[model samples]
Target chain A: MAPQGQVTSVPDDGLTTRQRRNRPLVIVHTGEMKGKSTAAFGLALRGWNQGWPIGVFQFVKSARWKVGEENALRALGEVHERTGQGAPVDWFKMGSGWSWTQRGPLDDHAAAAAEGWERIKADLAAQTYGLLVLDEFTYVIEWGWVDVEDVVATLAARPGFQHVVITGRRAHPRLVAAADLVVEMTKVKHPMDAGQKGQRGIEW
Target chain B: MAPQGQVTSVPDDGLTTRQRRNRPLVIVHTGEMKGKSTAAFGLALRGWNQGWPIGVFQFVKSARWKVGEENALRALGEVHERTGQGAPVDWFKMGSGWSWTQRGPLDDHAAAAAEGWERIKADLAAQTYGLLVLDEFTYVIEWGWVDVEDVVATLAARPGFQHVVITGRRAHPRLVAAADLVVEMTKVKHPMDAGQKGQRGIEW
Candidate 1:
């Protein structure tokens, strides 16, 4: 309700205003509503505008599923490459495929999810992306594929200025507690409530 | 929570599934949290991927305020113009001045807000864009600069397949009632709570 970028309270974290303000954020988007992943992608767009390298990791969504954000952002990445305007972008889906694994597509969701977390751990350590979006990652935590404590610890101690945004429903309490910004997307109304199927371009 | 594009129920509105699914939506993002405008901009990116023209109208934010979304989207617009990959994008900020008004930056806030609403009304009636983003528009209604009834009625009567998304906090009840998809962004945590100022690349 306050204007954008207004701080309400200040904690005694032994850091200066500049240090606190410039600290890389861990943002979590959770709840049983829409716009969780969409908003995460939106944040990636902002990061892209800032010439930040972006990495999108989809956990629940299938690799075959082509969302509009992928196309647009990929195109933006291409634009960045061509004109040297923005930064690079990388998108990886952890449903059937793991980019690091030699296997083509895994049948085991749990194994795929675990491997995905391992890759994320390596990326966090390397500080591969300025903005890393873990789309639908909460499900893996809720499903117990990845340890919440590990995630919290890894994110808390991530190297460099990497901003991590995790999105999905039923986010673990520990993850929420560790996050710098947590947004719960509550459904007030939805077309599906009226039995309407998802529309093209709107839903995808 | 359901997979993207999966419908939970079927309505008996006498329309086929395709027709029902393809219906344009009025999405409202409200509540006292971040990512409302961010999510709307994400939707606009999706619309742009579908080759739908996007028009962004910023109501409360000043023209001097240079958000990152504007830069990325405008670049995408240029990409569309050159390669014809995506649709065109137009951004209007109604704070210091109105595009239609010949007069320079107005000193009056109420008059500026009123004129901004008038321009949106005209655009809605004309069906100028496929996706119209009314960014931070809820404040106009809450401030009594624009009538909520007029807004709902105008949006309800909008012709063609235009999808309108309004983003802001404390949305009027009637506006929510008229919206097809309403997302209330509830804040669980924020960096600002710890007295952190907004960061570059992340906040802008």
Candidate 2:
């Protein structure tokens, strides 16, 4: 967190500073606390400022829920289109036609999650985005909807300079191992702990 | 982090859910890791989307450091000006003419920090912003440049619906006690631990 951006340790990875700096990263935001997805979206904001194309795929949350980041980031995309200031942004969520195939039950969240993973795999293969945010993706892995090994391997071998950030609670060990940076958002205190209900603007 | 935004516990405070939900919050982001400020800026993005005017005050970091959020948020302000979207944004940092009233040494950071805090007090009293981000302000409090008791008292008794978010490592105990929500960004694993250098787009 230093202003100079100091590295804590220099590895024997044999890569030059520039090479190490430019290397693509896999970041994981996990733990049972708030700000996991929020921090990932904040990174997307930073990536957007760098003119990096951002792709956000919400694995768990339904499209019906109107999160504030969705509107703000989509608005930023419009600004990019109009003023050519930031880069383009794409947002996708589950329960929004991922059930088009109608495989078995209408509440087949597992199947829908698998479909989302396939899309992410395709995007990774195509190198379609500079930053790919898999918001709440750990749930899919935790629920056995998606294979953690597959997710980690695909991200490790992802082509180009695509940086992927996964956010959710109880992240798989393999995913954490594969991540370059991992932050566990720990709750010291929450309004909910004091019996306060979540607000529209603040929580959403 | 539920889609339904369910409260873990309901208080017996006699307030309706609507009133409790409408209450303003004081959030503190503290720990020995990255994304403290980034998560705060993410909240600012949500606030801006809610049409809440945002005021950012940088306490420790100098004005010369070009962080990405500053540009993105300022661009968002421009978008608001052009298209009548979001809300107004204002950003301030230290070492940028708070020295104009120096009474002692040229490197009197304590005086500068105190002056920066005075402006915040004035803004809070005037109810100038719906969201005020005191970025890295905890450092000043940690260094005893500003009194923590005064800060807690002022924020606890601040007028109107102003929500304040303070971000830094090692937040004061009194401030944390006063906050409605507190998140400690714990580092599970860092690229720096493996000797990876910080990158331009990723770090800043």
Candidate 3:
């Protein structure tokens, strides 16, 4: 066990501390828990504190859904820009409407997601952000809007000091295999089992 | 699938939206994933945005360890106080001395942890904050420094609209049972598996 209550056994990563610091990270947050995206946002927040520009791309959620993280991060970015203390944060989303809706026509959804992926791909090639949050990106691969192999290869070959954090449930095994860090959030209990809907501040 | 990517099957909590809005929550963050503590901090940030007071209690890691989250949260609390945005945040840690070294004398460790838990218990009873982060509280129970049953009962019986967030790996089962929400972070892959140690910005 680690110094804390950690029960999981971590295998040897087999790298020098220097190598670990310099190497870019590909992190996957999957499983059936509530904090995958939130964790990624927290990470982005951390990176923002370090003055690393952040690029957040949402694959499944629509443009209408206003997540609190987006607002908070953007405000942080503004603070950084005005005072040169933190980092800049950019947000983007896909889908036709709110995530609750039908994605605004199934056919259009696929095309829109594809276009979004293309833009992110271009940005990745250009090393747009130090930290790139692919929020809910697994759905695109799961829904066949993007190929898993292509994503795996693209991320593996992405240039510069960029870090990509992907969040979603049921991440493809191949993607997991490529990740330097993969966390599967398991659900033990939830109020939603009792039929409580999502709230504005807490849920969003 | 939830309206979002939430996978937890929350059962009928027998709470109306208003009741839930008013009721304090017991949120447990467990499992082997690296982001357990990070996620809890993220949740705290979310609560901070709502003008909720944040109280963080660390059961492991010395008070000396300078976590990036602590600094960021402290800064955020400052911003909130100055600009009438976000919320206030307080951070505390326990260990023998500072964070980097041993747990002082092994014999005094348990007593120290118990003392720390006592303070947190008092705070919970008083509803000192809207969001109470029992960061790494699981270890105390795992090490027998504190009684899990007592902790669970106290949490279940906590009064007022206080949200408690507990984080660590190998959480006690009874604690999970009493929790309204539990997230188990499963580590699929880690840089530690390759022998790379924790990084400054990413790990802390």
Ranking by TM-score: 1, 2, 3
State the lDDT of candidate 3 residue by residue for B1-204, as single tens digits.
Answer: 557866466449776557765556788989877788888877776788777889988777563343667766776777777787877888877764423335564347787678777887788888888898888889889999999988988888887778888988899888988888888888788988897667656875
True contacts kept of 1: 0.83
State every prediction's TM-score relative to the real structure. 0.90, 0.88, 0.81
True contacts kept of 3: 0.54
lDDT of 3 by residue, A117-196 (tens): 78878989998899999988998999998999999999999977788999999899999899999888888888788665
Better of 1 and 2 by DockQ: 1
Candidate numbers sorted by DockQ from highest down: 1, 2, 3
The sequence of per-residue lDDT tens digits that candidate 2 reaches over residues A1-204 is 655888767879887677767889999999888889888888988899888999998877553343678888888888899889889999887865443344443367887889889988998999889999998899999999999999988998897789999999999999998999999999999999877877877788
Residue pairs with backbone overlap in model 2 = A11-B195
Predicted candidate 1 versus true structure: per-residue lDDT over A1-204, tens digit per residue = 767897676768877677766998889999888898888888888899888899989897463454789889898899899999888989888765866678788888998999999999999898889999998899999999999989998898887789999998998999988898999999889999998787778888
lDDT scores of the candidates, listed in order = 0.87, 0.86, 0.79
The worst-scoring run of ten residues by lDDT in candidate 1 chain A lies at: A58-67
DockQ of all predictions against the true structure, Cα-based:
0.68, 0.64, 0.42
List where candidate 1 sits over 4 angstroms from the true fold.
A1-17, A63-66, B1-17, B63-66
Error of 3 at A111 (Å): 2.8
| Candidate closer to the true structure by TM-score (higher is better), 2 or 3 | 2
